[model samples]
Target chain A: MQPVQPLQSVTSAHTDRSLQLTLFIVSLVTASVLGLIVLFIFRETLPALSGPGMLRFVTDESWHPLENQFGMLPMLWGTLASTALAIFLATPLGIGAALFCRYFAPRPIVRPFRALITLLAGISSVVFGFWGLTVLVPLIARFEPPGASLLAASLILTIMILPTVALMSEAAINSVPESYSGGAAALGLSKGATIRQVILPAAKSGIFAAVILATARALGETMAVLMVSGNVVQTPGSLFDPIRTLTANIALEMAYATQFHRSTLFVSGLVLTFVIAALAIAAHRVEHRAGSHHAA
Target chain B: MQPDSSVSCAPGLMAAPSVAGSTLLTAQVHAKLSERLFVAAVWLAAALVAASFLWIVADIAFHGFAKLSWSFLTEAPRSSGRKGGISTILVSTLLILAVTVAVAVPLGVGVAVWLSEFSRRSSRTARVINIALDVLAGIPSIVFGLFGNAFFCVFLGLGFSIVSGGLTLACMALPILIRATESGLSAVPHDWRQGAAALGLSKAAALWHVLLPAAAPAITAGLLLGIGRAVAETAALVFTSGYVDRMPESLMDSGRSLAVHIYDLSMNVSGGDQAAYASALVLIGLLIVINAVAIQLSNRFMKSRIQPA
Candidate 1:
């Protein structure tokens, strides 16, 4: 009986150890996926990044691919312009909606409001693009010759990102300690004054993180921007002008591209990866600060 | 002149304190007015956000609802989607989704279990894994498309096929699934683990029997979200899947997904707007159903957890 007990214990121990080891191996493989993606993308972009025309890739404005002119400045500008415009348009509305949800909304309305935001977020980007093409584009074309322009892309992006920004900001606001609001009330501060002075300041870092994350989302959006941004590889002088973004550029031309052109598209993707990485790092730092502040 | 001076002097004597009181009243009024304005503006913003969502849904339904029919859901698309249905695209989408779920769910759940159960939160290994997941999450889908093209399609000889696309989407969806599941597992009470240990149950038995079931709703929610994201994906699949509208007979066959079909119908094919709208309607309907199921599951889980044993 004693020998059997020891053997049973040993078998159970072995089984547990093997299970743990298998899980650990699976986790390691999962973690390495990011590294693999980076390696493959970077390796593919090496030709364009190290070529003689490397300088021309960033410096030149014309992207005449057949002529070997692969200047990405115009597309870069388009990406930045559309992202900035979307952020500019979305931030106020998003933050305002968050504030409303946190402080001003009636109790019965809050849940439904949040569900609406989530539903908006769940809608596919292609659907948004389709809607923009059929509905918003024609609306814009009433005032302009070509309806698909930077403005159209930015508007769609603004709608797409608003839910993200609002949800994150509401979370940040909710995380502010209850005592802060109580103290403001004890001091006889008005509701508006308390929100503007105490809560917003305490939640500032979190809101900043939310905006940065949303910016990353807007920058990476492809199909919607591609469908609406006219896909012209030229710099736009005005909001109404049609423009192409880096993401749109990659999606627009990846299918038929060969050799250097293919590598150049990869280069654009690599550039996007770097920028998104920077934003992610920044947002992480800000969120960490906010978390530590709350802990303290 | 003496009578006028007396009248003015009497009013001045009375008006001195009244002026101070009037200014204070006006100040209060100004604050109240500004507060009202601020509240109104916030409501307006919220209303606009909600209204935009309704407008998008309404616009799609208005355009596409008329075109939807039994045949549209069951027949193959004809004339570049200017006519017929999206049955092939629907099947391809489901197949790709199945592949993505089969690949991502197990890996994501394993990582979540490792992070929440096996490793300490402050450990360096866990931190590295967390950072990797964060970076992975931030990576754009188009970049995923590029990597999938380079790695799965060309390097591995998978070529442009549903398998390649599904694997690519699995990579894209992994981080979100892991984070969601990890949070769910972590939310399980610490006392529950101690209780299992006190009962002399093996760690794996306790996890499989107790912890996993407790966290099942969360895992389910995470999976549904992953499915939603993968189904909605267009950019990542466009290059990997090769846009063949025919019915995919196997994982290796190239196929066009619903989102990609909508994209092509709208962007590449002229006179395909009606079909695009109908496709969009179908895709949105699937997402809303997924979202509702997630909400229902979470709500039920919350209620059960709150109830006393």
Candidate 2:
């Protein structure tokens, strides 16, 4: 029996080794794919880096490639301004909806309410953009002619990101122990006070994580923002002013751009990559903290 | 004189709990008003979400349902996608989705298995991988578009082909799949793993025979979500996949997807709004069906698992 046990243990150990090896290799491949993407984009961006010194790319707002200028300042500003508008509009509504679903909604309706939010999240960005182009732009035009403007794109983006924010916030709110609220209420605090003082404070990290995630979504949003932002490659003077995002620039002209122009587009992509990576890292840290706190 | 003094002293103490004065009344009124306002605000937010969902669905259905037909589904688009059906684009979208699923599922599930089944919860390697996935997931699709152009089309020499586009999408889908599979795997109770061990099964065997089967539904749901993403993607495909209207003859051949088709028809082509709306309907309809089927399948699988227990 002892001899047989030794042989079986060896075989099991062998299986374990192979399993670990397989998973490790696969994970390495997954990591490397990201590395490859970053390397490739950076490599292609080299030509633009050399041709138009990096400072000019950031400082110069004139993006006429034919004139040998590749400034991304205007598109950068548009992306930031529109993204800020979206975050501003989505934050309150998302937190409120999450709170409503978690605390206020009747028990039986909660499941369907969540399902609806999930469905909204699943809807394609292009569909949102399509709706924006046809409906939102037209509505905006009632107040401001030409309809396609920063405000229109921002509104569509707000709706697109609402589900993301709400869902994350709901999860955060749910993670706060029921005991916390019950304890507050036992002290004679009203329901509103219990939620606002106890639950909301406890879920603060989670709500912030949700906002960061939404910001990433809004900044990276492409098709929908493209359709309604009017594709004008300029800095907008006002909310109604037409402007183009970095994404729209790449989508609109990448098809025909050649040599330096092509590399310049790749540079814009590299810039976007860095900005999103920074946001993603921030969100990951907050989410990780929140998750660990919940586990504890 | 003694009775009056005692009564007056008692009144001040009782007033702390209940004052019939205007200040106390106003404070009560303020609390009630604010509470009501908070409730109303929450309700309004919920209503806004519901209203937005309905508006988008109703608008798409109203515009595209009439345009949906056998001819529309089966015919090739002509006149810069202004007329006819989206057959080629539909097929291209399917092909891209297939390629992405093939690449992403195995890789994602493998990493998830490693994290959940093999590694300790506090392992640094696992944490780094999770962070990597978070960053990967947050990356914009257009960045993938550029990466595809630089890596696959220009460098790898795949050119603007379906293969290149699909591989790029595979990158985008990877993080989503990994996260989904990880959650699913972890959701399987610890007892199952211990039971398998007590039966003297090897780690890999237990995972293959027990853990994976239990998590299959969740993993499938995740795959469905990734498929939806690949289907809806446009900006990335633009640079990786050439905007060819014809159905792809081979993996190397460039093709346009349904999402790209809608964008082109609406933006670049003149008087093609009808086709765009029809395509939007088909795309949205496809998404709804996918989501519904995924939900049904996962629920059924979970129910079946619960019934025997």
Candidate 3:
């Protein structure tokens, strides 16, 4: 009986080891693929670094790649400004949704409400873009110079980030120990008072993390903005003005571009990636700080 | 101007009365004010969200409904952008969607199953994989397109083909699929595992019997969401999938998708605004139908998992 049990145990160990090795290889492959993508992007962007007017191209706002002129400042401005608008538009709606779902909504209603936000998140950017083009562009035309403007892109992007913020905020709020709420209750506080004072403050760090992630999402958005934001190479001062985001610039012109122009677009991508990474790092820092504080 | 995040509140403020069902003047006023403001804010957001949809739908219904025709869907794209149906683009889009799902779903599900049922989340390897996935998910589709173009289009010489685009899209769906699978597997009640073991089932058998079935709905929801994303993606496919208007004969054929068609049509439009609007409506309609199905599933199936509060 002892000899039989040892043989069975050895077989199981072999099976488990094989499974683990196979799975590890797959995950590693995925990681390597991502690394490869970054490398190739940098490789593509190299020529643009040495192009005739590389510095001038980025420093100036004029961005006609044709006729030996290329400037990325307008693209940078449009991307930043539009993303800011999206963050502003989404934050309140998301926070409110989180608050309602966490406290006010009934158990049955809460799940459906959360699902609706997630539904918005699942919708593809192309569909969002199409929705923006047919729906948002014409709608914006009434108030804007170009049918597709920075504001239209911002509006669409707000919907895109809403679910991320709301879900994250809800998780943060729920993770707060009930003891905090209980203490507030023992002190003779109203539900709203407790939520505002004890609950929100405790969850502030996580909420900030969520907001930062939403900001990253807004920055990373491409298709929907490409559809709604007028693909103009100009720095937008008014919300209604035609504008080009860094993302749209890459998507719209990458097909037709040649030589140094192609590399410059990749460079644009690299810069955007760096910005996104920075935002992610900031969010990680917030979560890390919160984690340590909670531990302490 | 401010959404309250403050913790300092007036103490002794109707703690018992609210629970005991008594209303004082000051407390009543505060409660009334709070309720009014909260309700207003929440409902207004809902309305705003709803309104955005309405504007899009109304515009499409107004335009596309007027011009709906068999020819508009069946005929090949024309030089005028107004003279033909989106049949070629539509078919190509469908093909790409099918290929993408076929590849992405199984691969995604397999990895997810392996991750959730096999690996410990606390392991350094798992943490690294998880972080890598998060970074991949956050990378812009445009960046994905750039990579696809450079590696697959130019380098591998899979020049502007459906397979190239579909492969790129599979990466975009990975995180969603993995996250969903992880959450779903975790959601399977722990007792089920113990019960299976008690019945003398192997670990794999237990997972297949007790866990997979339970997690199926959630995983399917995630898959559907991935489908929705794959359908709506444009950037990564732009360079990889050539703007060839013909239907793909095989996975190697280059083709334009609905989104690309719209971009091409809108940019190249010469005669009128009506054509762009009409095409936009078609694209939006298709997307709405797809997303609405996903929404229904999630709303019904993932109730406990969602965070509203």
Candidate 4:
């Protein structure tokens, strides 16, 4: 019996060690994949950086790949403007929907309501682009000559990002402790007042995180904005004018781009990655500050 | 200005309590009006959300649904994907999904198990891994495409093949799967673990027989969501998959996906609008069905689990 017990213990220990080793390998693989992707993009983008320097790539508006000019200011403005428009359009509606779900919607209706938003989130961006091409572009053409302009792109992006913002804000609102609302109730505040003053403020950090995530998503969006934003390399003057974004530029030219053209696309990818990382860090700080405030 | 002075003076007056009463009444009315406005705004917002969803679905269905047909689902595209069918791209999409699922599930689940069962939340290793995942999740799909182009297509000699695209997609799906599995594992009540231990079960046996089964529904949901992302992906497959319109004869052959096919026809193929619409309809319809089925299955599993317990 003693010998059998010793053997059993040894086998269990061995199994435990193997399980940990397997999990460690998985983590290592995931981390390496992330690191390798960054390294590859950086490595491939070096040639473009060598000739132009980083500032010239961003500041110059002449993006004729034929003439060796790769100024990206127009596209940068296009991306920033469209993403800003998306955030502006999505935030009010998203927060409003979340507040409605938290305060006004009955218990029986909330689940289906959430499921609907999740469904919206799952729809592919290409389909949104398709809708924009067929429906939105034509509608915008009523005011503008060609419908595929920055306005159409911004409108499609607004819809594409709506679900993400709505769902995240809902989750944030739900995560707020019930005790805060209870105190509001005890103070004789109306449900509307409680939601506006207490719950929304408490969920501010999560709401901010949601907006930043949505911004990152809108900026990185390619196919839908590509389809609607006219694919031109000019800075848009009005909502009616067509423009290209950094992401759309990469996808539009990658197929046939060679040499410096190819490297420039990779440089654009590198810049977009840095921008997203910056937003993520900002979000993390916001969350950390909110967490400490809660702990206090 | 005179009214403001009169109001202030009334507040100080002991003789004109009626003026103060009227001022309090107006203040109450003002509060009520603003509260009503906010309530109205919330209702309008909710309605807008619902309406926007319906509007998009209806618009797509109206334009694309009629174009769906039998050959459209089964035949290879012709005329630069402007004339015939999307069967080849459909096949390629499924192939990519298969490879992504096969690679991501084991690694993601393993990482989740390690994080949930072995490591403390406060551990430095766990924290770093979490931050790494945060970065991964935030990365745009185009970057994945570029990496796939350089690392898989060029560096690894896969050279714009289905295998290259599949591996890139697998990397993209990892963060979603790991996060889902972790949440599912965390959702399992603590008592279940203690109960297994009390029954004299080993830790390995308990996890295999008890906790894993309990988390199956959530893990399944995660898998379906990952599949949805893989199916919807375009930019990542563009460079790695080479946008060829043929049915892949082998893993190394380059192929087009439905999303890329739609892009090519719409953006490049002149006079190909109808074909593009038909493909979009098929793709969107398939995605909706997948999402509905996932939600239904997860809900049913939750119901069954909760009732028995």
Candidate 5:
């Protein structure tokens, strides 16, 4: 009986050690998957970068595949333009809605209103694009010749990102200590004055981080932008002009692109990955600083 | 004296007085007016946000609700989705979602258990893993499409099939699942662990019998969230899964997900708008149901947790 008990304990201890090791290996997949994605995407981009010497891809403006012209400036411009426009349009409305929900909204409706926002966030991007195509495009076409343009894409993007911005901003505003408002009230400040002067300042970094993250989302949006944007490979001179963003370019061309053209699309993907990574890191840093400031 | 007294008193009150008092009263009134305007403006913004949500839902329902029928839900799309139902697409979507959940849940739960139960919060490895998960969560789906295309389709020889798409989505879903599950596990009371140790229960037994059930609600919520994300995905699946609308014979055969089908019908197919509307309606309905269930489950679990035995 004593010998059997000793063997049983040894086996159980061995199993426990193995279980921990197995889980540790499983956890490593999180980091490895990310590493593999970066590695694979970078490897695919090497062909285009090395073949075109990187200069032509950057400096050239047109992206005709058969002619061997692979300039990404126009797509780059489109991505930057549409993302900036969407952020510009969404920021005020989102922040305002956040302020309303936190400070002005009736207490009973707040939870439902937030759930509504979450639902909006969960709606598929393709659905938003389809709606834009079916509804928004026609409305725009009433005023312009082609309804599908950079403007339509930006508008759809604005709607898609509105929930993200609003939710995050609401959370930011909520995080500002209640004591801050109490302090303002003690100083005899108006409710509006207190919100604007005290709460907003305290939540500024968090709100800024939220907007930055939303910008990254707008920049990375593909299917909706692909569906609504005219997919014209040109730098738009006006908001109404047709344009193709980097993401749209990759999605549209990757289906049939071969060798060089395919590699170029990979290059576009690589560029997007880098930009998004940078934005995410920046947002994280800002959020971290805000958190530390609050703790202090 | 009146002006000074008014200043000292609650700002809401206005007392009648002489010339200096009148100016002060006007200033206070102006501030009050601006405050009213600002609040009104904020209310307008919130109203606009709500209005847009209504507009989208109403428009989709108005246009697509009439087209939905028993046939629409059960038949395979025909004529580039100009006619017929989305039965096959539904199958493919479920299958892909199944593969995604199967692959992601175990791995995610394992990582979560390791992080919450084994690793210290301030450990270097834990920090690295957290950062990696953060970056992974932020990566765009289209990039995942590129990687899936390059690695899974070409390098792995999986081709453009459901398996490829599912694995890609599993990668995309892992970070969110892990984060949610980790938080859930961490939320379990320390006393429970101490009790399990005092009882001489093995770590695995305690986790299986005690910790997992407590965290089940959160894990389920995370799973539903991942499913919602996978169902809504278009860019990631299009390249990884390929765009063949025919019923996929197996995991190896390319299958078009609902999102990708909607994209193709609306963007590429002429005269496919009615079907696109129907498909979009179905897609949105599925998401709402998933979200509602998650909310209900979590709420019920929370209430149960709060109740004394």
Candidate 6:
């Protein structure tokens, strides 16, 4: 029996070694896929990088690629400005929605609202684009001096990101123990006071992180913003003026562009990747930190 | 609907159990102001989400109805966005969905099962797998598109087709399903598995029937989420499912899904705003349907599965 046990144990150890090997290979493949994408983006954009007046790509605002003048300062400005507008519009709403869902809503009503929020989050950007073009454009046209402008794009984007922000914030809020709130209430604090002084502070890191991620989502958002932002390469002075986001530019032109024009698109994509990557890493770190605090 | 009741929870007066008037008054004013601010913020969020729904309905209703008769859904592609219905695209979406689920479920479940049930407690491989899944989840869709373009489109000579799109999407959603399934199985009560094994059930059999049934809701939730993501995706699908408007008679055939069609229409048709809006509405409607159905199932299944004993 002892001899047989030793043999069986050896076989089990052998199987374990192979299983570990399999998992290692999966990790390598996943990492390589990301590496490949970076390589391709850089590779595809090489032509534009090599082209004339390459230093002016950052400073030149007049982006007539056919004229071979590839300045993206205005495009960069448009992307940043619109993204800021969206973040500005979405932050308070997202936090409030999270607070309402987490602390305020009655038990019977919470589930359905949660479900709706989840559904909203799940809807496609293409669908959002479609909606923006059809519904939002007309709505904006009613209010705006000019129809389908930067404001319109920001509004659509703000809506698109609400669910993402709300859901994450709600999760963060939910993680704050009832004990904290209860203790505050017991100490003669009203519900509002308790939530503000005790709960919101506890969930601050999380809510901030959620806001950042929603910003990334806003920045990366393609289809809906494309349809309604009027696709103008120029920068906006007033909120109602037409504008284009960096993402909208890539998605719009990637299909037809060639030579320097194509590589410029790759540069925009690479720019987008770096921007989102920075945001993702930061948000991810905050989320992890929030999780540890939650566990504690 | 339930928001009003929450709003009525009077912020200031009931703040302290002692209920001092001065603090109460100040708190009330503070609460009133903040509450209004909160209301504005939350209402804006809710309004946008609600407007998204309205946009879909209004867009499709105005434009799509103008164009969509029975023929709109049942017809083929045309040069003008005005005439073509999404019949082939819709069908392809469904077919691709079916294939994706078929491919993804088994592969995801197998990996989940192997990891959750078979892994050594301290195995470095398990940690590697977890990290790999995390990195995979964070990857942008464009990368997946690039992969499909090179590996499937050029190297493998699959060309742009539903098969390639479905496969790529399957890869995208794989980590999601596998993670969810693992969490579900882990959530299964240990005693149930033990009891099953004591009753002469094998380890595999115990997991299959006894443990999995308990974990089914969670796995289903994950699958539904994946489906929602897959259905809504555009970038990767654009590359893999070539822009052919023809219906996919076989998995090998090239076609657009509803999403790609929307992108193609919006980008191409010079004044296709109406069509784009209409297409958006249809896509949003489909997304809504998926969400509603997933929620319904998740709710029903989760309720029944909660162990009373």
Candidate order, lDDT descending: 1, 5, 2, 4, 3, 6
What is the C-alpha lDDT profile of model 4 across A1-296, one tens digit per residue?
A: 23336677678767877888788778877867878988999999888788636676866567998887889888999999999998999999889888877778889988888788878888878888878887889888987768899888888888888887888888788878879999988776767778888998999998898899899989999989999989788888999889999999999889889988899999989989988978877777787787776667
Sort candidate 3 into its docking category: acceptable
Model 2, runs deviating above 4 Å: A1-12, A291-296, B1-20, B295-309
Cα TM-score of candidate 4: 0.93
User: What lDDT, from 0 to 1, does candidate 6 have?
Assistant: 0.74
Q: Rate the local accuracy (lDDT) of all candidates.
A: 0.89, 0.85, 0.76, 0.84, 0.88, 0.74
lDDT by residue for model 3 (A26-79), tens: 767766766888889999988977656568666655887776677778888898
DockQ of each: 0.60, 0.61, 0.45, 0.58, 0.71, 0.33
Q: For candidate 4, what is the interface RMSD?
A: 2.8
The list of candidate 4 runs beyond 4 A from truth reads A1-4, A106-109, B1-17, B194-202, B297-309
Better of 2 and 6 by lDDT: 2
Q: After superposition, how far is residue A7 of candidate 4 from its true place, in Å?
A: 0.4
Evaluated at residue A167, the lDDT of candidate 5 is 92
The TM-score, computed over Cα atoms with residue i paired to residue i, of candidate 5 is 0.95
Per-residue alpha-carbon lDDT of model 6 for B87-153, expressed as tens digits? 7878899887887898888777767877787776469867656655655665556656656665666
Per-candidate TM-scores read 0.95, 0.93, 0.83, 0.93, 0.95, 0.83
Candidate 5 lDDT over residue span A45-147, tens digit each: 8878885358878766589888888888998899999999999989988999899888888999887888888889889999999998888888898999698
How many angstroms is residue A86 displaced in model 2 relative to the true structure, after the best TM-score fit?
A: 0.5
Q: Which consecutive 10 residues in model 5 chain B have the weakest lDDT in total?
A: B1-10
Clashing pairs in 2: none
What is the lDDT for B124 in model 4?
Answer: 92
Error of 1 at A133 (Å): 0.7
**Best candidate, DockQ:** 5
- Residue pairs in collision within model 4: none
Better structure of 3 and 5 per DockQ: 5
User: Across residues B1-309, which tens digit of lDDT does each residue of candidate 5 receive?
Assistant: 334634633486656666667667677777889899989889988898899888988999888888889999999999988999999899999888988998999999999999998889899998888878888888999999999999999999999999999999999999878977886787788888888877666687788998888899988988888899999999999999988888888999999899998999988899999898889999999998887777677667666663222
Q: lDDT by residue for model 2 over A130-203, one digit each (tens)? A: 88888889999998989999999899989999998999999899889888888986676677867888999999
- The TM-score of candidate 2 is 0.93
